[model samples]
Every structure is written in structure tokens, then in C-alpha cells.
Target: GAGVSQSPRYKVAKRGQDVALRCDPISGHVSLFWYQQALGQGPEFLTYFQNEAQLDKSGLPSDRFFAERPEGSVSTLKIQRTQQEDSAVYLCASSLDGPLREQFFGPGTRLTVL
Candidate 1:
């Protein structure tokens, strides 16, 4: 089975540009999560999805951040207006549907907002 994957492993965007990041979770794993990690900080949870339903998005930093899982599978995270402060590694992880299970993470999409 395929593991999680992210596209354009690295990106450089000018300030105010919009960028979209993609994630594909392991087949049949029903829980998916998106996170952001600053240079020295641990990954911070951005949003969580159970199946196709977005259950929590409290961690989205601003209105510019959005995520979706339209088919109960592959997910996307979009940043509407990139800023220098938004430069960070965005990660996606998935696991068996529920809390407390160990999560398998993808190699993150590294975004540089210049």
C-alpha cells in the first residue's frame, strides 16, 4: 500500500502569493491531520478530518489557511496569501480512525515565503 505523499517537496513563493499543498494518506486509514512546523518548533496541529468531515480546524492560523477532504480521502491545504511568517514545513499524518493511535507522517512540504 502507498504511504502518505506530498507534492513539490519544496516551494518558494513571493509574498502575497497563494499556494496549495497536497497530501495523500495511506489507503483505509480514516483519520487525517495537517500540521505546520516552524524552524525550531514541534509540528503544530492545523486541522483534523474523520472521513470526509472536517472535525476541527482550530489550529489554522488565519482566514488564509484552508483545508478539505472532499472524497473522504486525499486532502489539500491552501494558503491564500503567503507571508514570510508563514514559511515553514507543512506536514500531513494519518492513522487508524480514532484518538491515541500512533500516526504515520509524510515527508513535509517545505514552503519558503520570500
Candidate 2:
């Protein structure tokens, strides 16, 4: 794709269900990041991957959240045992090298836990 693209622009999950959000970044981007955004707040960083290596996951809220970039291109963010509090927009972004570079953002997957 020309830019970052995310799957399932809108997702509805029942409580306790698990959801996986996918992201396909620009062809050669080396940095991928996952973020969670609540209705009225800014996006919060969840995790970061640099060319298939998970470099930082300190921002993840709990054990239920997991993100990976196996080949440094496509990435997935999984949320386990979804709860009402987990309802938010999950965003994915990619940069050329590191966090310092400009990042391209995907449309984001909005997950609603019912």
C-alpha cells in the first residue's frame, strides 16, 4: 500500500472476547508503533517494533495487550479478554527508522466492547 493501512475499521467485541487488529505499513518503514486512544484524549503509545524486534512495550497497559511485527512490515495488535474499559481506537504508525522520524498513521481500528 501507499501508506499505513489498518483492517476492520470498526470492530465490536463482547466482553471477554479477544480481538486482533492488523496493520500494514509503508513498504520499507522500519519502525512500527501501536497506540490506544480513548474518546477525548490523545493517543497513548502501546508498543514499538524496530524491524521485527520489539524494542519497547513499556506503554502497554496490561498483560492482555500484545503487539508484534514479525517481518518488520505487517503488524498486529491483540487484545485479550476484552473489557468495557478496553473500548477505544487502536492506531498503528510507521516511521522510516526510529521514533525521531516522521510517522505515517493508519486509519485505526475502533473496538467497542459490549
Candidate 3:
């Protein structure tokens, strides 16, 4: 895809189930980010990866949440033991350099944990 692309645009999971969300960023983009957006709130940063190195993950809410960009092009966000609170829109974005530059966002994957 020419832009950031996320799979499973919508997901419904049972409580305590594990889920993995995939993100394919724009070709050659160096910066990738993961964000979580609640029903009425804006997306909140979860992590940031520059190339294949994860430079920042302080925004991740808990140890159950993990994100990685192994090869710098594809990224994945995994949520273990999904809780009701984990339900939200998981967004993926990519920029040419860093967050300071304009980011291209993908259609977020909406997760609903019941």
C-alpha cells in the first residue's frame, strides 16, 4: 500500500483473549508510532520506533501491551489478556523522519473486548 495500512479494521474479542494488530507503514518511512484512542478522546501515544529500534515506549499503559517494528517496515501491537478497558481504536502512523514531521495514519483497528 502507498500509505500506512492496518489489518482487521474491527475486532471483537472475548475477555482475557490475546490479540495482535498489524501495521504496514509507508515504504521507506523511518518513524512508526502506535496510539490508542478511546471513544471520546483523541489518540494517545503508546510507542515510537525509529527504523528497527524502539526509541520510546514510556507511553505504553501496562506490561500487557507490547509493540515492535522488527524490520522497520511492518509493525505489530500485541495485547495480552485483553480487558474491557483495552477496547479502543488502535492507530498506526508513519513519518519520513520523526514525530516532528507530518505523519500518515492508517484506518485504526477498533477493538472491542467483551
Candidate 4:
């Protein structure tokens, strides 16, 4: 019934700290997506899940980045060994069952590593 929502709208993590970002997609949505947006750049797809299965995760920058949609409605993106370069906005989006590619995005979780 609600749109996608992400926790910790802003986060500050020291270098090497691990972080977990959460997302709650709209109920009944068939598709969920996670994106990373760097300053002054377009968002990059990190992963995509349909239902409880992760259909694609080719965009994850490294092995440290992991995503899961265990129950198909809530998703989490975990980043291990946070680095300064990992600072960016993590955005979550969800889409309904349709032929067109359309997704509603969350406000984004801004992570800043010091």
C-alpha cells in the first residue's frame, strides 16, 4: 500500500565499517531494484529482484556489495569495509507488474564514509 521506503536517510560510517541499508517496497509489487547514485552522476543499477529471487546482480561494484530480497517485499543492501569511494546515495525502487519499465524510487540513503 505504501511506496518504497529506505532507512537512515543519512548515514556516516568510518572507513572499514560495514553498513546495511534497508528498503521496503510497495506491497504486492513484483519487481524491486537497488541503485547507487554518485554526486553529479546518473544512478547505476546495483541489483534487481522479482519476488524472493534475485534475478540479476551484475552491477554490484564488488564482492563486498550484497543484496537480498528474502521475502520478496523487503530488501537489504549490505556493504562491507566501507571506503571513502563508497560514499553515495543508495536508492530503492519498486515496480508493478507491467510490460513497461517504470519504478517508484525511495528518498535514498546517503552514506558518507570518513
Deviating ranges (above 4 Å) for candidate 4: 98-100
Number of clashes in model 2?
0
lDDT of 3 by residue, 12-99 (tens): 9999999999999999999999999999999999999999999999999999999988888899999999999999999999999999
- The sequence of per-residue lDDT tens digits that candidate 2 reaches over residues 1-114 is 598999989999999999999999999899999999999999999999999999999999999998888877899999999999999999999999999999899999999999
The lDDT, on a scale of 0 to 1, for candidate 4 is: 0.92
In candidate 3, which residue pairs get closer than 3 Å at backbone N, Cα or C atoms, i.e. clash? Answer: none
Shift in Å, residue 94, candidate 2: 0.3
lDDT at position 37, candidate 4: 100
Q: Report clashes for each candidate as comma-separated counts.
A: 0, 0, 0, 0
Q: Model 3: runs farther than 4 Å from truth?
A: none
For residues 61-104, what per-residue lDDT tens digits would candidate 4 score against the true structure?
A: 99999999898889999999999999999999999953156889
Mind giving the per-residue lDDT tens digits that candidate 1 earns over 1-114?
Answer: 888998879999999999999999989989999999999999999999999999999999999999999998899999998999999999999998854688989999999999
All candidates' TM-scores?
0.97, 0.97, 0.97, 0.95
- Model 2: lDDT equals 0.94
